[model samples]
Target: MSNIIGFNNAIFWTDDTEILYCEFSNTDPNAKLESTKAKLYIKAITTLCKGKAMPFVIDLTETCGTFTTSVAKFIVRNSELKKLRISESFIIGTTGVKLLITLYKKFYDPATPFRIFADQNLAQAYSLETKQKYHNSIKKVVEDYK
Candidate 1:
């Protein structure tokens, strides 16, 4: 499931990869994302995760950072969805001021770690590596039990 625009500020996902890509529109400064869409985005992510922790690579390349809070609020409101732990969140090109905010969040929610990078490639690579390690750890546990 992928290529969904104006739905959640998120864009793509594929079966082969463990990355969820979110892009807040750089072109439209006043792009309004309704609350319903925010809920849907959370729903979509939870469904995609299928009862496992999932990491996201958010591309905040060029956009006012308003819509992000809406999504966060929805996640906070849902008690059952708390188990949808974000293994990692890589935000691209949010340096200087936004970087500080992200840093605070990193410490605030240590359970779901995150990294900031100027380059999307680096973020994606690290996300893939983290994802692999998670899968390997889970696999080892299952094998041991078997």
Candidate 2:
């Protein structure tokens, strides 16, 4: 029963509160994905996540940006916030992706599972885990109704 609510470039999937899956394809450079959109998504999910033992996977594989310092800070803030809510959180950036891990080295916390994979397998694995969690939640609800 996992659902993704999105519009244009921003997408938020609901499966794991601790682990939110998001992808931003900047259709226009001026819009700036890091603005309110990214922050809202983070705040919304964090509020919903509460105390779930979930992790996060932010897929920036299709993103295109200047990778400015501001955007990097936004990503870092959200990543750290996710970790605080979940057991752990990781950001998955593909080869030649938009977000640059090096730029945020100063703010990078080793305790958080920050990583970049050559491909989307790691993100996919996280999504599958979220799906399973959703399925179980739904099953439990159905059993309760029965």
Candidate 3:
């Protein structure tokens, strides 16, 4: 596993098993994850995927940031992003975020498969399984934080 990218409160990378992972920091309780930060995340995912479909795992455990309805819509509306992802996405977070994810799924009905997990290990295992099922590989190009 290698750290390929880092933002203010998040780190993005492809693990040894080839699952794309985005882990948000838990220290900042007041941080708000707005549309701009969402865009940056999209950019990072696009760069990492490089037009290939891969399983994505988001670790939101202990993060205080909240996503607005508009931010969720922004992610769903990103056509380019839609093309580069596998059918499933796994998110790890608290109960509140899990509820939010439920609402998002109900409202958005995203084309991709999305699941929420309270356990990070379970999420990672699922992601790796998905990658293997689809025969995807870890991205070869790794970029340092800019």
Q: Of 2 and 3, which scores higher on TM-score?
A: 3
lDDT values for all models: 0.62, 0.54, 0.73
Q: Write the residue-wise lDDT of candidate 2 on 108-130 in tens digits.
A: 53444445554556655654565
Pairs that clash in candidate 3: 87-113
Tens digit of per-residue lDDT, candidate 3, span 1-146: 46488887888887566667888876665566688889998998888776777788887775765667788788888997777666445465567767766777778755677678877788877777776655533333222322
Candidate 1, 78-121: lDDT as tens digits: 65456655555545554543664464465445456567776788
How many clashes does the backbone of model 2 have?
A: 1
Model 1, CA-based lDDT: 0.62
Task: Name the top TM-score candidate.
Answer: 3
Worst 10 residues of 1 by lDDT: 1-10
Give TM-scores for every candidate, taking all chains together and pairing residue i with residue i.
Answer: 0.68, 0.57, 0.77
* Residue runs of model 3 more than 4 Å from their true location after superposition: 1-3, 26-31, 87-93, 135-146
Candidate 3, position 18, lDDT: 61
What TM-score does candidate 2 reach? 0.57
What residue pairs clash in candidate 2, if any at all? 19-55
Collision count for each candidate, in order: 0, 1, 1
